[model samples]
Target: MSLRALPILFLFAAALTLTPISGLAAVGLAVGIAPPATVVETPPPPPPPPANVWAPGYWAWDGTKYVWVPGSYVVAPFPGAVWVAGHWVRGGHGWGWHDGHWR
Candidate 1:
């Protein structure tokens, strides 16, 4: 490889390594404002499809407003996996959402 190409290759590799780190940083940002009270709604019965799990929706910060995401049935990521619903918790900086994950 040419000498100039080596620097470019190094930059490309560095960018690839840092891309996911930046994405994770964004995902971990905590909202400083407390979301409004959650709306109570009765979820409809599960669909006829088997292995469908209920993912209860919550308010999501849109960088401008708190948008309500309605609950719905979703397919579990894997067999025997349970969906842990996301929730907002009080933190040092007002409130932040703890993202849900499959358990």
Candidate 2:
């Protein structure tokens, strides 16, 4: 490479090596950088009937594209309880799913 291009090439190489994980903060920092907020398209269908407490659907990574999974009615863990909405959480390298549950 030409001398002028050598430094530019080195900068690009360093950038690649320094790229941080999606939720990671600065290197060696325990705090994680919050992921960019996601815009959910076509919100999950309305929760199932009262009998099946509705669990809000969330975006899930499916290898190639983000897919929406329809929410379903679930039997409450106990009577007179409510269902907590599901959410996506940051894991070590990627996002993980926290399923809805009775609260």
Candidate 3:
């Protein structure tokens, strides 16, 4: 409402236009910025039995900027399941998350 607040509001809007996505898929979260490129991570040695699949690192939006979520080994849901990495997608509203799923 005041002129002093206008600059702060503008800065927030600017930041959104240069950053990443929603906060872990809320009911309806949209981000104006496109996510940064995916981080290249060399996965560590596989863990013990049943958890050998490496879900590579990805950039996650933390309501502000993109944060690097390190890759980790996870157990496959089924006998021979393949892991599909999640990524950012552009939609009518804005950028949103396409959560990774098993194949």
| Highest-lDDT candidate | 3
Evaluate model 2: give its lDDT: 0.60
Q: Candidate 3, overall lDDT? A: 0.81
Quantify all predictions' global Cα lDDT against the true fold: 0.79, 0.60, 0.81
Task: List residue ranges in candidate 1 displaced over 4 A.
Answer: 1-26
Error at 103, model 2, angstroms: 2.0
Per-prediction TM-score to the true structure, in the order listed: 0.64, 0.43, 0.67
lDDT string, candidate 1, 1-103, tens digits: 8998999999999998876553355365577778888888776964537788878879987666789999888888788999998998887766677777899
Better of 1 and 3 by lDDT: 3
Off by over 4 Å in 3: 1-25, 46-51
- Write the residue-wise lDDT of candidate 3 on 1-103 in tens digits: 9999999999999998866444424446678899887778887764548756889988877777888899888898888999999888899998887778999
Candidate 3 clashes between residue pairs 3 or more apart in a chain or in different chains: none
**Candidate 2 lowest-lDDT run of ten:** 25-34
